[model samples]
Target: MEQYKGRAIVQKIAAGRIWFYTKEEQSVKRYRVEDTEKEWKRYEAARDEAVRELNGLREKAVRELGEINAAIFEAHALMLEDRDYSDSVKNIIETQGVNAEYAVAATGDNFARMFSGMEDEYFRAKAADVQDISERVIGILSGRRKRKKMGKEPVIVVAEDLAPSETVQMDKSKVLGFVTRQGSSQSHTAILARTMNLPALIGVPVREEWDGKMAVLDGVNGLLYVDPDEETLENMRKLQKEEQERIRLLTEYKDQETVTKSGRRVRLCANVGSVSDVAGALQNGAEGIGLFRSEYLFLEADHCPTEEEQFQTYRLAVEMMAGKPVVIRTIDIGADKRAPYMEGEPFHLEQETNPAMGLRGIRLSLEKEELFKTQLRAILRAGAYGEVSILYPLITSVEEFKRAKALLKEVEEELADFGIPCGKVRQGVMIETPAAAVLSDLLAAEAEFFSIGTNDLSQYTMAVDRENPRTEEYFDSHHPALLRLIEYTVKNARAAGIPVGICGDLGSDESLTEFFVKVGVDELSVPPSRVLPLREKIRNID
Candidate 1:
């Protein structure tokens, strides 16, 4: 085998192995397998092993990556534990009773034929994962595939599109990068790649059977090649080394305050949804939890959380911050995030072609007073434990703000009457809707603070349905019009003597940090991993 270099991205080195991908050509390939009974048993055993291994990974991911990442791991586990696929394979084996190899061969052949006729590329790729899994299982059962001792030399792996199991099964120590023909940004494989921090690229075509061949994977550009010239490889290696060096330098000051060259200082906080993320944020050097999503209290449960449950959760988050501010948004649920317990409320069963624009956020809370009241009571009860503030979502009108504030006041008074210790809770509004942005001055008069939720604000201002692919191009958060809305809201907040911050994808974007600062954003809350990098970027901003 000839040795060639691929653009290498060093993912986390764990368990003495590395995992990555190399780019390869996009061509249909055929694998012939014979149908047999022994093959079916082998497939079953392999499936069992994969399921067990994936479960262990899921548990680890929950502890390390937290609940959102844990959900991703669970999704992969379910895909492997697909009941329909397993049952179909079982029925075929029982009737045919063929040899193991033949059974494996027939299963692949049949599924390949069926999938080849499908229109959706995602479904078509499913056949490849199934075929690969069956082959790996059969090889292990038949004693054809052996565990090879991979050397220390790194290699960029190239493939059409790899299965989750295939990616996870490799000896990660030798894998330098990953390039695939297909993968969405949110695909399981892509998520794994990101979490692992491997420089990788997907959804690009590779050429020819180049396995064990000298190749180069340019992850940043999504390119791969075989037998590249020396100059090309050397340039890529230099770039890679420079990036690592810069990262090392950034690590030294990760936990320090980010101050500009002229000593203009700004606070960096984290936006988190669950308690599990609290430790990670603090460890990553976040000053505090800026936007604590309170929606998790209402999601993934049979019913609304009790006041004490929310209090405990909020208290834990506040205490973890160690005197840092925790701005918790009240339950921001609607048609898209419907809770099982709120099925009888208006818009509970309401269908919308564009749920993003439908009755949601503060509207749901406003229309359903009891539902809103329950969450208000919880936030109030939690306030005595630490410094906490309430953020209301989707406030398009002054009346919604009035009603929500009035209800919160009533809940606090009722709690006081019941001898429950409650303290002052500051209130704010999330300026996400276009209507809300237009009326920022009015809302700022009553709302104590303002937070521009650019995710929804961009969608509303652009009038683009984010979920619809046809309008995806129109969903630009950087559009001049959206920025004007942000400017409008920020200006209003400043004029009203209320603080404003940005807690969205826009905040984490290092390129936009200076722009956000220029716009007079007081605080920038982002994901934990981005805090340091953004701090580094902001420190240089004029």
Candidate 2:
């Protein structure tokens, strides 16, 4: 028996034979080509073919995984048409007088290297994207398909790494789980695995010889047992049964109120990125929509989503909640979450040395008045359909909060002037920074409610970039200082006679549930899947 430890992407258990995924190798051979025009034409043909394949995969991703995940392939398609990338391939082929495949391979390597060398974690992740697209085009040129076929039965797929496109193209039914030798938690493969609700592990030392061997993938413990002994298998089966029984028991609490043994009640909500996530929230008995991340509607688009587009999306979410209160945060773009279209025209976002602390959230909204007003109008209009609260992100001071509210009021007046029916929206502020937490009392006086964004609060309070892996050890979400901030924020909110909720990763931490309840947190909002488990935890607390 062999035991290996890895990082878990999704917490689940699966037992199956290992299947080593072998990608078709495209060995590009460099050769002198006399006909430069012919080579350029060949490259163009391959690019077109690759785009077609990407589009097909994108459609599949949309049908299985929603539009947000499908955006990965859309990006690959756009990368194929990027002028710098395509121009480099053309230049190498024409000037160097080399075959199209070799030129493409060379261009991919150079671009991937450049991206890999970038300091920003987001940009560094793009290096893998460049390689995926490059390999795709090269495969087309070489008349080979990059996607590998699975066997007849389900198996645990073992691979060095998987591109987003490759993962989406696989036969999902044939896949029991995934164990990769190399991948980060932020990798698209990890995201896809979570979306697919499949158990997955990364950073495992996978071996080709382990193929076809019985394996137990214990995602909860991040362990993989290859050809495990009888006793190990028995213990694993017992654990799996317990997990299944635990899940069954959780359903009993789904329809029950989230109240403690002492009869203390709290609102348990879900934070969703898109409208499609609302169904899951309802299934898991989310009392309301806590943090509706409105940025996704902008991020997934090639251009700025018009006021009507944003309105429809927001309206759909509100309506889906079926009269449940939905708190919609305004477009929180910039920093890691960037829209390419915003880089041009009137909404030009300048490059920043420290983007995380730069123009983002409410700052970007305030700087771009028209953009801000457009969203405010949509949220107000969506409010007519159902209960909707407009929450502004990154509120560092009272002045910023007042300025944002002033704009919202102006939009309401504009709607009234135009004789448009606009519903009243509850105003709220996101206490994400130390300044915001300290000034919560003043802001809460004017704001209807408060939502503590613990993710950024911890980051800014600790002066650590949460997304940067190097800062992982230092980035403490449960730091004493962060808890003090949350306690302070909640205390202020209570004094101001306004409810306060947490809408960050920390809200989902079951270990902190009792602490939050004890701190007088009015609500705990987390991902849809965590709602029931959190509710179960809340019920057990005194």
Clash count for candidate 2 is: 0
lDDT of 2 by residue, 237-292 (tens): 89889988988889988899999999999999988767777888898899999988
Model 1, residue 376: distance off in Å is 1.7
- Residue 30 accuracy (lDDT) in model 1: 33
Best by TM-score: 2
User: Could you say which candidate leads in lDDT?
Assistant: 2
What local lDDT score does residue 219 receive in model 2, on the 0 to 100 scale?
92
- Model 2: worst 10 consecutive residues (lDDT sum): 338-347
Tell me the whole-model lDDT of each prediction, alpha carbons only: 0.66, 0.84
